[model samples]
Target: MAVSTRTSSIGGHQREPSGTLRLSVPTSYGHKRVLPLLPAFRARYPRVEIDVHVSNRSVDFAAEGFDVAIRILPPSDSSLVVRKLEDAAFVVVAAPGYLRRAGTPQTIADLQQHECIQFLRPASGRPLPWYLHEDGREQEIVTAGSYCVSDDVTGCITLLRHGAGLLQTLRFMVEDELRDGTLVKVMSHCAGSARPVSLLYPHRRALPLRVRVFIDFIVEKSTAWRRAKL
Candidate 1:
């Protein structure tokens, strides 16, 4: 039997892009979106080694040595290069059981009657306002509820999925549930608000080949993911 062996070089001229890529991403986004795409990225750039740090807090690029970072919100550091990857769309959703028991909310004002789950901001410990895009204008609704989750957004999602209450969350996080009828979308008229997800890296004269390809890869994939959802 004859087997073929592939070399890392093409005709002994160009070497395959190879190096360790240190990445930091939020826990929920990392688990749901970024981690799933890694197998394909690895298959394409087999020689590249990826060291991923999953956390919700900001990291110091120089201190942490992270080559790239994915952020759902804008990074405060002005020194690092920032590139907007995609808008993480948000939707207000509830488990069908919850909707059935609590009654579905039909208008932005109707949310007042429903048990809206709140996600508290880590920096300020204040509940994040629900951003609703209605009538071609964006409005921030200060929502209050008996239940609130902090630090990790996934906790809010868990409570929502179990029929605890309603939640406004990234569309990608609840896509499967929305499709499977486990969860149902409410307030369709005001569902277009989105959070910009950006990529961060240190400013350098020339980015390493491995980092360059990864940036391109993620941007491409994110575009496709957004289009599919649309």
Candidate 2:
């Protein structure tokens, strides 16, 4: 069945869109990227109630009954409607103190001498490889860390701020830190990897009005922001 959008009104006065919107988003990205934009969304659709779930793990929309899922990586379900939103570029960063003590890595080989902070999967406890591009090609290097953190990307920012070690994370998350000289981008010449961010929802003949408008609102607004940036 299609969920039709209806504008809420009081005493025949025209009003904004009204409905409940369930949105699932990743922890770090949601706070850094999506959360700030939501106030605009709420203002546009005044009566719309949003239930946002922030998690470091994935949510199964089909079974979990989520109206939408915001993910950094590509959507796993091909049948669902997916919109590619951002490049979500990453940078290898570290506190200046750490770099001063351990020395900055100029290349992948140099990383072996530094304490590379690695992020392992919370569920599987497996260390993921880092993807870097340099010398005209992309390379995947198995990473090891003296200080290992599991699951959360935001944790990397916290640790790096304290002069922990080198960590590769989404650039947007650490923009303030980078700009304020709290963290420094290391080996920027070799930093060329990013994940695709997407808005995911199950396929249906008729999309919910709230979902439709929300997607359009954010996508259009984000496009404009990027344009202004360039």
Candidate 3:
């Protein structure tokens, strides 16, 4: 569902929101995207204390006492309200050195000829398939390589930087490297597939002021982020 981007006003005799906000988010996203925005959010909502929990596992909002969560995939539970934060685009990239040695791949079929780094799923302990858009549809392509990263997806990026192999990763993760020409994108024709990151919270008729403000803050920030990236 669409989240309203309206922010809470502190002016004109309105009560300033003050409380602890328990937020749960994925590790990578928490570090790269969310954490950096906290300082500004704090500046605006000075009295609101933020308690962040970074993990990949699904949280029990009621049992765990979490007020809000950010997830890459939508939850199955119907009781929780889901609002999309942003669509994270994944790109196929490799260091210039690695591409020079392996030869740049021009097509999706060409990826098989190169060493494609495999990112293992934390829950299943299996390699996560790469999703790419092709001919108006998304295709799941299972890739294999000499290197496998388990638990932490960022490990693949470390290997990628040292000319280890080709990697398909979230574009935001390698934005700096790509800008500096340290890494180069390949198979651009198949690169538009994106996964939606969403904000989740349990359904409640009346939410606390802190939670409501945090949700509005996140929605406002993410909308700007999407615009800036575009």
| lDDT for each residue of candidate 1 in 1-230, tens digit (9 for 90 to 100) | 43112223446576666889999999879988899999899898899999999888899888878899999978888998898878888888999999879898888888888888988888899998999976789988887788988888899889999999989888889988888888988887897577889999999996877888888889888887778662
- Name model 2 segments beyond 4 Å from true: 1-15, 224-230
lDDT of 3: 0.85
**Clash count (model 2, backbone only):** 0
lDDT of 3 by residue, 1-230 (tens): 55332334345445667889999988778877899999898898898898999888889998999999999866899998999988889899999999889899887788889999998888999998988776789888888799998867778888999999999988878888898998889888897577889999999987888888888889988887687552
Cα lDDT tens digits for candidate 2, 77-99: 78778888777787889999998
Question: Which residue pairs in model 2 clash with each other?
Answer: none
- Candidate 2: residue 85 lDDT (0-100): 77
* TM-score (C-alpha) between model 1 and the true structure: 0.86
Task: Provide the clashing-pair count of each candidate structure.
Answer: 0, 0, 0
The 10-residue segment of model 1 with minimum total lDDT is 1-10
The C-alpha stretches of model 1 lying farther than 4 A from their native spots are 1-13, 134-136
Give me the runs in candidate 3 sitting further than 4 Å from their true place. 1-14, 134-136
Which candidate wins on TM-score? Answer: 3
